[model samples]
Target: MPALAVFTATAATGTMRPTIATAVAIVLAATSGIAVLWSTRVGAGVGPDRAALGVLAVACAMGAVASGVQAARIHTLAAHPLTELTGGRTGVQLLVTGFDRPIRSGGVMVPVRVEVTGSGTSARAAQLDVVLLARDGWRGLPPGTRVETSVAVLEPRSAGDPPALRALTAPRVTGLPGWTGRAPAAVRERLRQVSGRALKGEAVGLLPSFVLGDEGRIASETREEFRAAGLSHLAAVSGANTTYVVGAVLLAAAAVRVGRRGRIVVAGLALAGFVAVVGPEPAVLRAAGTGAIGLAALGAHRTGRPLAALAAVVLLIALLDPTTATGAGFVLSVSATAALVLVARPVAQRIRRPWMPGPVADALAVCIVAHVATLPVLVASGLGSGPWALPANIAVAPAVPLVTVLGTSAAALGPVWESGAVVLAAACSPALWWLDTVAGVVAGLPGSPAVTPG
Candidate 1:
């Protein structure tokens, strides 16, 4: 709950109590790692599948424990360095860590890593301060870049007012980030550009959002239509999208006769890259952690229950970012994913008719479980939904993988070959067309009664 900025990678900026937690987590991690090794032993009388699952469970525990250690390492500043500077001007070098805060003048609230350049030398570079940077181009400074400027430190005028460090003069970019920053931004921009050129109207906006979870370009009306159609989760990157993207990459890696260790490497790298491309939101981070676990199991030549992975990933994310433990996005995502894992297959078998295809029934079941699981969360916020949501989701469900896989492919190819990316992106047209059309039709349908959470 301290001043925090979550990053897309395995990092965060926050104040926290450490020591005991870190030591305990390290002990737990070591024990879990040993369990993973022991699970691999033969003659345990357990079936191969069960043994694999045990190994996976242990591995997930180990990963979560490691995350706990890292989280505890985000040290709390001993004193409020800026308390006396309220209502005063001071010099400082700041890094725009992320878009945690949006300013009214198109600038953003950046987490400033304070390196004292003023007479006040008590501030440490290790400490981060949330401050307003209302200068031109300040918002665009990606993670790891530095901003140097004089700033007026202002106290919170109200409970909602986060302490602001208003730039007293034009802020200058004193540092630029290397590939750690540029590569992801470039890839995302390339995808955006190709999407603009290759797709028309709403698809241009929706494609990037669907593939990369960047819904910045989606119009308010389009978003509303999707919401009405019970497809709003599709607008942002959800856990399933992350899993599917990772799964597809795993399939591709396997196609070329990649060994188990090699396939793990391939999938691991792909999962990391996908996370980077998507921008590490809470849901994506949860999914990424889960995906990473699956990939790790693959490397070990073992498999784990998806449900176990989901639970462990949830725990891992909570350990890393405690603030997100009660977040709506986290709750909704976990609910929807848990539903799919627990009931999708069983529901698929029950619902399949003599004429219905297995995959189709399975997909339908997935849609059903997801819709059912997330509906309460959706309506709890007063975004009233109805029965219309289910059929609308069913209509658009088939296109989801097509849109995700091909759309990701196009985005990956965008930076290297714009023309090739466009060609690959053309495959997503039918899917995109159907999505927009379904949202429109469902939004217009009569008798969408609002369902309130009791």
Candidate 2:
């Protein structure tokens, strides 16, 4: 991820305006394109090994130049149009840059984070990121929608939130999400409705969040319990979610007698659909990439190197949006996945005994290694977990998959099979009850509060 590091640093420190940045990017691209062509032609004349090495070197150089140009685009916040407003309030138009996370509701007013397209009609669309405290009207709107309003720029309210920009007045919807966004939005809403109708109390709130990442309805108390228990990641759409969905899709495809190549295509489409339904959080994005690699491995009937896949995911994401690297969730997701890929199996193998079976050893390794993998990050960020966190996660681990699969199946059956959906959702009551019991028990334990720095 050296390229990622370079790109992020450059973007964070870039000072060029949009015009200059764009011009530079075009120049870099043209130069790289020419060099790449020249390398291909000249290298063909040399021995095979030398030719391959030459091509690889040219590719790396091109990547570095492209990274610099992208950094220039990311650092657009430093331009005069945005810098001038950083000191005070101003009216501007903003575009929703991502649809990954849901808009957070703080009572009547919601905090909707949208990227800055421009501060005014005359301002260029450099796309500086900011969060807006907007009205109820902003809720349920899909990403890619545009709103115009006045805003007061201020320091970020919290680590997870970006720089706060309070709306002086309610934002007016100037544009709607395109047709491509409508289906995902609709699917999410339908699933939420299905969950509400099929489940009760804790299950109602937990199911959608667990299956779809829609945590809006979760009670504050329940959230605290999950947090203290370190089971919050269960609601973050982990790889387990994708595994269940993809696994089911593959099974169905197989039953229908689809060939290997066709199954891959079907699984890819299904994975995309699942991401849309869950919405795009950093965690969800990570899960999707990992799931894709898992599917590829399955297709080849070979145990591909997972560590390499993880690195590829990191690199691809850096190219797509290096800004994702800044999120705490991203760090935790990548680190934990890497730990599982690299450390979990060995630990499990060492711990395994005749009395302790493979499944138990694997589960123990996952719970322990996940916490260890994320420990440094959490500590450095002044985040912590209770003494009960690890035990609680381990205790609740088995129940998670049960809740996930049933919850997912219920949501999938919602529109077409309402009664069946309700029945399946009702089936989750036992697991939900167990999860709640474990979380409450763990949270109430002495020394369960996350440790804070001295």
Candidate 3:
């Protein structure tokens, strides 16, 4: 709906700030107002489209208000009592809630969240978020690990970022992740080792990232190359990854002559397992939700109106979690999906000629339109998108699908059959090589990372 887009824009632009009750009142008032206007419009020039837009606009406003409330709540939470003490050390027991992949700055920086359990002098418990900066020893800790330590509470780096605390000494590990978290961690580790062995050189580092969304082993140079070329999103798993996974499952089910309902059931289960393994990152979560909506449309035998389905999903998610309206990634995702739905097919048909096959035309059209669609969001977010993005994507486009299919197969087979996993990984080496070459060449071009201000 036009209102959905307008309200989403309003939210993204950071204009509205209503309380929870005010948001509710607005929704009710808007709904009644639209109904009255639509009914009384029989003698006027007002149309159904305009009425529908009014309804959708109210829905979006409601979402924006809710998101503001959520943001305020989070900010208040970050003002924890532990964070108020500046330059003070306190003995606290922490139960690890989440762990970010460690990165090396001046020293190794490990970002994590923990629930502080008071010990020794204090007995209060509170949830705290901080980044641990050290040269080593942080890599061993996983989610659910308990570590006892003393730390100096400091101010947050910026207004939006999480609060900061410094750990001077290595925390004593008291607990490790139980089976819930251990399974995914173990699987990721084995897949990394297997990918390294099967693919040589850069492919070893890049393949796992393409498949499993793990870029820890990739070289800094290569990682920068990807960012410059605007291909970094491919390395981070997203909706496309989920779609390919579910599509593969559906195809296999079809080959076995499975019933429609049975195929849907199998695909749903596969999608859930994939998300769990991938660790529920924001992009992954959004992709999973979009994929689930698509699957539901298929099960209902109403797959023709994918544009409508995508809109519904976007509106619903925005209403439930309003902050998504302001995220560049989420905006890019919606824009990209919209381009595929509306522009890809027509562009494909126009470009299809005697020399090009239909599928090839479609693929090229998708790459071009997706880049074009997300340009505005990129410019707004200051992520340095440029002309290089289109060509780089076109150059390596064909290799991506192959890498995803084969890499996923390798990951699934690794725990069950090491030999099979290696074979699948070896099959993906050529695609990975091509991808690496494209990134290298494109990233080196002058004016590659053009940063246009919004």
Candidate 4:
């Protein structure tokens, strides 16, 4: 476990390097793990063998280091010559990959991931972080759209800034999104239509965000309210959302009298569709992993170790893409998931009273555990203290499952059968109102939930 601390500490803070040091360290880690496994007799303990645990920990450490290095390599901007473009303007072509969240202070800054193909002598292939000043041509472009522009490039002002180059001039999109990109773009447009037709007021803007993770249409005031209520995570498609989707599918299967195996099959199909619709982004993949592991545990009728499951996910993900180690979102996700697995059950038992329903107790436990577990991370990330979060979460806990299940059903049926989608949306409206009400009340309190950074 001490070794795990060493590994995570190094992985979290260490810069990427492609050197003999990394190779040697990885080799040593592998050998140490293998040697431990070999010396300790198989089936040595009634529970898990200590040797196996040691090996797993060591392997995870190596995986973390290797992933970090790989991510550093992909971030070529880390090594780009800032001196070359610091004082002068250059005509650079950028393929828009994704947009970052606009800041809360009413400014339109889109952090875009792009492949740079500069003009003239500067022409070269490299992926760079570019901040697009959202204006006439830059705003509302879906991921995979290509924008080419010429402007001055500036150095990052802060360590936490996402883009390496900030364009001083407006961008003109040179190319439209590819066919593959068109699917997501079309789906988003459909979502906008459905929301506008089925819901009203703030719900119209927030529904797509709640179900599809599209915050492009949310009002700034609504965003602030959600942030203050500590309900901001609902906008993101996470494990909780995945869990609801699978649960809804399973319920449908059961209603049809499907056998256990058939239900599993249905759940799998649903998971695949969900992933496709959500896009195979890192967070979505993580959510999928969490959901799959949860399903596996339930199917086996065994309670697997949550910590081990989390570790395995970290190792596998890091090996696939190292840059995840550096993402604050990833860190928060892992921590919150771990807390759910490790602490939620025990807290549920402790808080359960004779009068309280078991489901209510469990929901409250999860809300409290997740809030407490993520508090340090939130604080470190400058989210500050959200004193009213617990009550707000508890109030809306029941509505989450309803909103997810009914809303997903509506979205699925919307394109197929308009009448059916409307029916489902009608069912979902009450839950949406409940959630919105809770957020509105909690956010209206005297002080901001976000604490001032000292």
Candidate 5:
């Protein structure tokens, strides 16, 4: 039963390679069941509970068989030639499978599953991943798009090495000879329209990336600054952005006298819209999963435990992509969410003064939560464990929601009303400037502690 629980939980989380782990789990379960059956048949005291145990043993055997079958399927899927493409080999075409945006990483990474047909041989691959560094003129090719590129295919080299870096040494292509073509016209048009309205001069190039995860125009220097300052999450399609957008939509609904149910409906729509806009990367999807769970809790009038929700989401995500079990972003995202849920409340309560306003308290809570959660990783990554992170976050937290909502709205409106977009962008400038300043100041502090052993 214990083995079964672990297997089931791991599978549901989508974080593990189902075939290998599930197979091992099933084998262990089968062995245990056989041992239990043999003991019951031999002359062990077979009481009523013992009989129940026998029945459970039989159930476990059946479950093992089922898991074995599933494992076989996963093995077959993993064995496909196309999916196996790794190791910096050249000359292949693949279909863009998936992507992610980690806060600590400077750019988006894309994973492709290729169907290679060469020398009259055809093969299919599943989720052959790659990293697409955000470049000045780079645009994302949508999923199912067949891009024919001469990429170096590589394989997973070591446990300690980063997956993105490993992927670069060996790469594969999907949909070659027949480029899968660009993203849908509607999506492109919407992006262009949004970009045109929300951006001007220096900011114009960053609009696509900010709005849709298309990081073609953002300058390299700006990207570096964001990473060095620990503010790179702002550029990613993370839960922070999603939550802010959803919250804004809910607030607007409330202002117009929308009831609870109505507000939920609006929130759901906005969440969906945000996902669409951001292109459904894995990290964003995880964030969305947690956000949805949070909304459900709100709707039920229950105390929404963000940590529990994050755990549930992590479990699910891990089951789906077991490889991500090793990804730093996965660890960081879960930690950040846990921090917000578990630590923020207590910290805020402790620090709340009689003179503190409701808004200030809320802002402080947000900072405390995110800062506490991310501290271990920040330190471990050699980015410095500045005790001042909390204060800096507190100072910046208040403006995050403002920047997300107004900036997104401005970008969306930029194409429709350039003038309105300009106004909204102007309104957002102060917050962006302040955020940049805080990051710069905190990052510059001397003798910050490193979480990892030097």
Candidate 6:
């Protein structure tokens, strides 16, 4: 379902590549349905009797019909005028959707849902992608805050351009004007307190990001180091990060002899709290949903169906917020988790070599599976296309669990134990240094692809 959303979003953008991809997915889905029916009938020693054939035919037809309906919905949503007003001068009133931390461009860009409220007043509702340029005063708007702005809407520009076009596109926003908003004062105060507490040291800074998904306090140099080392995912409230937190909590509960039912209840509460702390962003929600399904499967002693859980999460999230069908992060998060669950074990089993130790073999397998799963996306997004990514991931994978666990503990306890935070910070410094070195080395390798416009 998430893949379908991505295809739909790409198709809506009128990009030929995405359109072709969507068509191919539809064809493959149809073929798979027929293949399933054929295999079942042939393998069961039952001839394709009239009733069985009829049932199979109806099932295949329903599958095709469902796919068609979803495709049509995507096409219609993409064709909406709001998605197309990219490269021109226009006035719009936009409801601020979300704000990302400032990138290297020196200003933050925000996503807003715009409705035409100016002279071309047809009273039509369309989602215009608007970006507010944050120079000085505009740097303070938080996610979930509404900003009303007047600005020029430009077309999507390539990443190589000088002052890359800050215009709005289907999924991301580019350029616009100044914004005005009366933000919630209490939220501002809370943020201020959190930020103030976090600036005391490296541990405090890392803690805020771990606990609240607030990376604003982390030093620019530290942030760059993590990015260079490919450990930046630890900073985000992703599935791995959440899993570590929940696992720690469950372990502590079990150590105290908590009953199975009690463990489930505690884990559920922790999951809810973790979600709230991370903010209800699409990626976080997807991770939470995936984790919940995983826990349920474990409790029931079932060999969990990660793909089915992922599909269910995608459908539910898309139905709630159709726009998420377009976000790249959402796609990446779901894909990564699915890869971990479905492909890791099999790949690990196949890599048993005489020279490799058991632990080394396990790590290599996981890296291979995840990289293989994400290879298409990495290529499609124009990141490095080399197979070297898997080796790099294997080398760095062990450090991830350590960094995530300590980092989260530091963050959760920073408010109460400054000395403890100092110790965690000291322990994390070496890991951070190692991570930074790896990223810089890999990134500097010849042919390492960088981010490109889609």
Best by lDDT: 3
Q: How high is each candidate's TM-score?
A: 0.66, 0.75, 0.79, 0.81, 0.71, 0.67
Where does candidate 1 stray beyond 4 Å? 1-94, 98-139, 148-171, 250-266, 279-283, 291-304, 379-387, 444-454
Residues 1-454 of candidate 4 have per-residue lDDT tens digits of: 4324433634543453444335545665676566566556456556567766676656555644554455455344456543356656676777665533455654356656556656678676666555655434566666676777766666555442333555556677778877555665666667677777788888877777787777777877777788888898889888777777897788789998999999989998999877766655556778888766544533342346656776777765555544554466766777777777766777888999999998778768767886787778888887654678778888888888788877776776776677777777767778888888888888877665642211
The list of candidate 6 runs beyond 4 A from truth reads: 1-85, 115-135, 156-235, 293-305, 317-328, 345-368, 385-388, 409-427, 445-454
Relative to the true structure, candidate 2 has a C-alpha RMSD (angstroms) of: 6.1
Candidate 4 — worst ten consecutive residues by lDDT sum?
294-303
Whole-model lDDT, model 3? 0.68
Clashing pairs in 6: 86-154, 87-155, 166-174, 166-175, 167-174, 167-175, 228-439, 229-439
| Of candidates 4 and 1, the better by TM-score | 4
Off by over 4 Å in 4: 1-77, 81-89, 99-101, 107-111, 129-133, 151-154, 157-162, 167-171, 294-301, 305-307, 349-358, 450-454
lDDT of each residue in 290-315, candidate 1, tens digit only: 44543333233233366567666665
Alpha carbon deviation, residue 217, candidate 3 (Å): 1.0
Residue lDDT tens for model 3, 387-412? 68888998987888788878887887
Candidate 5 per-residue lDDT, tens place, 122-225, comes to 43334444454332212344565565544444444442122232222223233432222232223434555545555454355444444455544555655545
Q: Provide the lowest-lDDT 10-residue window in model 5.
A: 159-168
Query: TM-score rank, highest first?
Result: 4, 3, 2, 5, 6, 1
lDDT of 2 by residue, 409-429 (tens): 777677677888888888888
Spell out the clash pairs found in candidate 2.
100-280
